[model samples]
Target: MAEESTKSWADTDSESSSSSSSSSDSEQEEVHYLIDDQTSDDEVFDFSNIEFTREDLVQALNDMVHEYKTLSHTFEEIKAENASLKNSSAKSSSDELEDTDSLKIELSKLRIENELLRSESSELKAEVEKLTK
Candidate 1:
């Protein structure tokens, strides 16, 4: 049993070595083919329409930068608008609080007037009873 195991292990190692050698050869061939294909592809790129002026590229970049600045300014304006709206809301809330206080004062005054009217009606009832008697 021990001898059989040893033989099996040796056979497996030999098989692995042979497989690795074959894979290495295939990889080298693939690398050589890729190098040739790249050279061939470089010959096919169309260079006729390629612009050589640095000024054109610079102009395009400047335009993009200007647009970016405009967008940034718009964002700042929006932020300022939001802050102004928040301030307006705060002012309105204080105004509403003042209005609520005014309403409370008016309610107290009405209650006092109602008590006075009830007292006057009771006095008039007493005077009417005395005259009838």
Candidate 2:
């Protein structure tokens, strides 16, 4: 009879442990489900609080317009400046081309003069040699 009681007590202990584990699992699942529900509700509630008033919208739009105008003015100024720089650069390039042409003409004239001087020097040398002979 004592052995039977001991066996009964052991069976009761195993049953309780298993039941407790199952209960704990179910409690964890419930907690997770509640957390998910709360998170969804909180997100919805947060969105509801983000209302934009008409005045705020108007101010934002006006600010954007002002910024756009300023940017447009800046862009136009840059374009004008760019055009001026291009004109100046073109004029400078034209001047440089003219200078190059003038230098070329001067160099040609100098070469011709150098050749004439060389020819004269050769002729003078020949005449001197003949007189000496």
Candidate 1 per-residue C-alpha lDDT over 62-109 given as tens digits, one digit per residue, 9 for 90 to 100: 677799999999999999999999999999999999999999999999
In model 1, the worst 10-residue window by lDDT is: 44-53
> Using Cα atoms with residue i matched to residue i, what is each candidate's TM-score against the true structure?
0.54, 0.60
Alpha-carbon lDDT, every model: 0.75, 0.76
RMSD after CA superposition, every candidate: 19.2, 23.5
Task: Give the total clashing residue pairs for model 1.
Answer: 0
State, as a TM-score between 0 and 1, how close model 2 is to the true structure.
Answer: 0.60
lDDT (10s digit) by residue, model 2, range 1-133 = 3455556667966876777777878876886676566756444222223474434445555677799999999999999999999999999999999999999999999999999999999999999999999
RMSD (CA, angstroms), candidate 2: 23.5
Clash number by candidate, in order: 0, 0
